[model samples]
Target chain A: MTAVSATPTATPQPRNAVIRSARDSLVVAKRNLIRMMRIPEVVIFGLVQPIMFVVLFSYVFGGSMKVGGTTDPGVYREFLMAGIFAQTVTFATAGAGAGIADDMHKGLVDRFRSLPMARGAVLTGRTLADLVQTTLTVIVLAIVALIVGWRVHEGIPKALGGFALLLLLGYAFSWIGALIGLTVRTPEAATSGGLIWLFPLTFISNAFVDSSQMTPWLRHLADWNPFSATVQACRQLFGNPGVSQSPAWPMQHPVWASLIWSIVIIVVFRTLAVRKYRHATS
Target chain B: MTGAIYAEGLVKTFGDVRALDGVDLDVPEGTVLGLLGPNGAGKTTAVRVLTTLLRPDSGKAVVAGVDVLRHPNEVRRLIGLSGQFAAVDEYLTGRENLQMVGQLYQMSGRDAKVRAGELLDQFNLADAADRPAKTYSGGMRRRLDLAAALVVRPPVMFMDEPTTGLDPRNRLGLWDVIQDLVAGGTTLLLTTQYLEEADRLAHDICVIDHGKVIARGTSDQLKARTGGERVEVVVHERERLTEATEVLRGFGKGETKVEDHMRQITVPVTGGAKLLAEVIRELDSRGIEIDDIGLRRPTLDDVFISLTGHVAELKEDAV
Candidate 1:
């Protein structure tokens, strides 16, 4: 029954911009994670697709595909596991784009934009949340991979390092998804826009087959692909059999190339996405 | 003292259409200003500009003493907005939606939870607090969206057609909630196409059309401006409509309008009930048997027609 004062009761002290940005991002991430839990179908569907890929690829292409000059099903399984893990992580881009586009269509993005939070928080939070989901899917896929005779030859630390590189690449690609989401009008459009270019990007790389076996021009392009760099890095760190003998610099030092490519993508795309978030909504 | 919300000469355009064409507005502390307009009158555009969701191509706005263009985040901290569309997350439970809004407003997690529970009860969503918003009825989702806006107890609020799609009962419920907020000294700028809503809730009404404010006044003042009381006569016989119009025009202060379909004749008059009595006598003498006759004050509808040269197009089934 008390009359409210026109003045704010307590103005929150102006904190460091970095700290505020981080705090706001975490709040948004928490919201997305909660929504994901509520509709367990989204997470369950995400897990099902990767598991299906593992089983279908292992049984169908395992014996036919050659890795390091050998057509052994077991060796192909190990080689295929890294590519599948990288593919699983990157494919999360579509979900991220679709989720953001849905939010925009429903006016949820407007609600978030009107708040006193940091401008980049919405996109950063979304990308971070998708990264978590990708990590979970990767863990589950690794278990599924092990059941199909995929093995890590490196020590446990190196194997974990490989997973880290895969996640970083996934996080970077999500920024591109974020940009597409902001540009498109509907969730369906964003999902399609996100995936249309990715098929060629993932397939054209050395994720599924040896780059050296392809034509000279195609091999050069695949060896230098950012996606191929991550896949090759995972193979090196996991001590799998798909290490390339190509003279491409990325193939020679896959780990450093993976780091640089992911960092550049993160920097370029995050800036574009956040800028699009501000302008497109207006 | 200056008003709690103020804007001057705000202009925003999309390609060839000026969504907000040089609009000016001021809402004093603890009062409601209703922005009344028909469809596509830039009510939503004005609200968006004032709420810092869109930057005006020209002019300035201030909310709670902060410059909207220069310090939007600070202005954002002082205001709450419930847009035309219910912006609640469908996947999240009602409680979670409110809590998320509170956290975004920078409240502590525990405090956000406590506030969410309080809003759930106040908005009559206590039973549905744990249910996902997707399962909510249309009215329930609207209540939840309004509850989310009030989470911070902001001093200035903007609601853009908050009850556009609600049934009558739900609309009344929302009106009661809005009245309570204003009673607690909140400054509100509400945009609605319904004149009855503006008359019932606003301290002042601004009639806008084609992105321009045509008239601004208190409800009674606006009705007074439209003109004096009117004598409406519905003739029993369709053939007698012209006769009734002639007789009423003799007693009228202005031109009389006759509708052949309804066999009705309406005219403006000064003397109210006394004039009504005289008109009936005149019509009876002329053998114009009237089925219905009344002296009624000018409604906001009359004001809208007089100012804009058209009736406010109302869709009762918009929900």
Candidate 2:
């Protein structure tokens, strides 16, 4: 070991602290990613549910559900892909919450707190790692979607934009999960809390059945939903049906709505989650 | 700095319960100060406040010369804390856990790796370095957690009940490691419920109860406060206990306490060896056959009983 001062003389400058915070977040993210790798089950199980959703929803409801007034299995499958992709990314919330609650339960967060690292790095790192995991799950789900006759007719860049939007939504929701994870005492509670509300959130959106078939009030609620906006934007970018929708601003201007919704969620939830973290630990 | 770790009039409350009530502490550099207390004695709460993990409602602490509330980050840089719970990541390998801690302390990648390896070896965790800490026994996990705290080798360290659940052998091993750290110039403030642990390791011991410092001194000094040495004699026959008590009272300084079931009589005294000899001779002359007789110095247990009006609660060991 090298001889270093008990208290390092060079206190990190304000500018340096920002850079250090980013670096520390990456370090923590790396640890989380490594854990997912070593366990294998975390990623395996994460992929399993979305794949099940892809296969089950495609085969089971392909012919029955109507998309753009067509009951054709082929057309409906493409429409279903957008919903599955959105669902997969958002479903990652439960896993993110469970991960954090587990860490707190085991006192790992306490260990991190005792160190001289940036305060927000731990939560940011966790969400970042969950983002990476969601990315991988999305890629694998995209491949499964393609196999099941879902195509991106809009070409590569737009397709990439669609995937990027889905990821943004996922990353945004992961912050909500982070907040729940911080609040809940047990991982089990976090898991249930993360998932229970998400069911109605995704179901009532433009993701699954075209919200147009629903009654007036249900249609209105779904059209205005932020989740519905992201789903609608992905459908447009993917060059799939259901792009033409009601006059709700979020529905009509889906791309801007998706970006604005995700950005707003990130800003609001990240602040709340970080505040929750400091309070819970303190 | 006058003391490596110093605090004055520290007070913290959770709802209605005051966890720390006007607690003051001063641990000189390169020495060990043991905060000895029973369960919920606010020892852990004090450590949390001093380590900047929790804010105190009133008073101040300067750890390694950094004001805890004003410059918590500075205090963090100069101190390492191993909390009451062993705070290691169960998913990470022992080596990985240490490496992560090293990186958090801002050590370079290569430096972190090197330090992690050194710590694994130093803590006798090299054999299990590659294993996930979830598979580690309680003692091994504790060693890993302790190693994590030492990753940056800060000048001062706070260990809250560092050896609480370990078996005796592992406890001894940890004590050795702590002593070595102190020898290498690390000032330490360790909280423990074990009197024997404080007696063996602490340069000074502060006994606390109900969130306040009840007594403060070296082991011998605190023992002396309860009174001087005691003369204890156990008669072979229960009927002869009265004779033994009479003989003990002749030379004893305090009231003679007789236990009929054990046929034992104990009395406090000032003169140590001469008092013991006189008791033995008198008991023998009075036909009080003895099972055992000895002069006993007061232990931390007795001091605790004297100060708190009760025993230290968790008497896992006889001491």
Candidate 3:
């Protein structure tokens, strides 16, 4: 072993702080992803809920829901898959928040803060991990949707675009989760706080029901909701049956709306979350 | 030589309570400065400031010659910190935890892997290297945490109550590791409520109370400040306490104190074991029945009591 002299001299560390920060974030992300792989139960449990939603909503309410001027159960099932995919990605926010909150509660964030790495890397890395998890969940949910007779009439490129939008939306929401995780004191509180608002946000949107069937004010609210925009965009991209006439500009241009909404969310929440992280660990 | 850790006039307040009030510290390179304080005495707060984890309201700190507030990132590269709580990731294996930290410190992948294996072996965690830290005992977790701190072998280290929750055997083991680190010339500032721990580890002990340094010296120096060796005798009968006090005063160097209720008399003395033997022979001839008698040096406990008028408020967190 080489004897290390404890001289208080500045060792020549890698000077590119920016590059080091990016590398550090990737390292943290890798750690989180490895943990998920080791604990297959997390992935399994994450898969179970989306699978249940696909099966239950397909069989229970499939026949009664009207879409594209018809009550055809098959058409509704096809329409519902897009909403389920969007909801699944959004709901991953809870796990992201809980994971981050648990890290904070355990003093892991303190450890990261004391290190000479980028300050925002810990959070960005965590959100990146959630993005990977969301991507995997979306893949498994798509197969379940296929098993339930849901098919995309759009070209393969458009179908890929829809999945891309779902992942992007999930990534954006995970930042909000990161913010809540930093704000809350416990993992349990973060889980509740992360998922509580999500209920109304997803339920009141055009994901589960037709915004055209609701009252004028309700339709307007649902049409403009960011959640609805993603759902509508996915529906159009997948060539599903739910795209009906609506005066809401977002609904008419769901693809552009979904991109803009996700970009805006990523910008706002990432800034706030990183700021909160600095204050919290400092 | 430039001090490895130096801080001046650090002041921090949480609302009305000043956790650290004008605290100054200087720990020259290649030495250990034990920050001895009771609960809530600002030892941890001072450490936080020096480690760049907290920004003091008004202070100047230069750690490893980097201005803490101005170049905290540069300072961070030169120091390692093991906090009061073992901050190892419970979900990651011991080796994985160290490797992750090594990578964060910008060591290359192969170096991180090799270093992790080396640390795990050195910390006696080789057997559990592949097991998640959550499955390890408290001592094992602490060892892993300390190992993480040493991954880069930085010039300075700040360990806040590092052995607070360790068994005696584990604490001794950790002490040996620390001794090895210091022998390699690392400067350390360690904080602890256990005076014994401070005595065993610190080159210089700074005793703080109520957010201020009340005394600072070498262990022996501080002990001497409390007083020299003393003779303590508990008489077999309460009525003989006064007579015992007079007998003890003759042998002792200073005023003798008698506690009538406990039948005990105590006094400072210069002589070591020879004086103790003479006192025993004299008392035996005087026919004073002795229940217990011994020569006692001033321990850090005694020093703390004399200086602060209260025992160090030790919590039973140490296992």
- Candidate 1 regions exceeding 4 Å error are A1-14, B239-243, B277-288, B314-319
TM-score of each model, in listed order: 0.94, 0.95, 0.95
**Cα displacement (Å) at residue A268, model 3:** 1.2
Give the interface-residue alpha carbon RMSD of model 3: 5.1
How much of the real interface does each model capture, measured as fnat?
A: 0.44, 0.46, 0.48
Q: What TM-score does model 1 score on chain A?
A: 0.96
Residue B39 of model 1 has an lDDT of: 84
Give the residue spans of candidate 2 off by over 4 A. Answer: A1-15, B285-287, B314-319
Q: Kindly state the fnat score of candidate 3.
A: 0.48
Which tens-of-lDDT digit does each residue in B1-319 have in candidate 3? 4477888899988778788888888888889999998888889889888887888899899887788999888777788899888998888999899999998887887888998999888989999999999899998999999999988888899899999979999999889999999998998999998899999999999998767888999999999898899999999977777787888988878888888888889998987999999999988998999999999998999999999998998544221
Give lDDT tens digits, candidate 2, residues A8-69. Answer: 42232334878899999999999999888888987998899989988888889989998888
Error of 1 at A203 (Å): 0.8
Error of 2 at A232 (Å): 0.7
Q: Model 3 chain A, poorest ten-residue lDDT window?
A: A1-10
lDDT tens digits by residue: candidate 1, A24-123: 8998898888888887898999899889988888789988998899999888888888889988898878878988999998989889988888899998
Q: What TM-score results for chain B when candidate 2 is compared with the true chain B?
A: 0.94
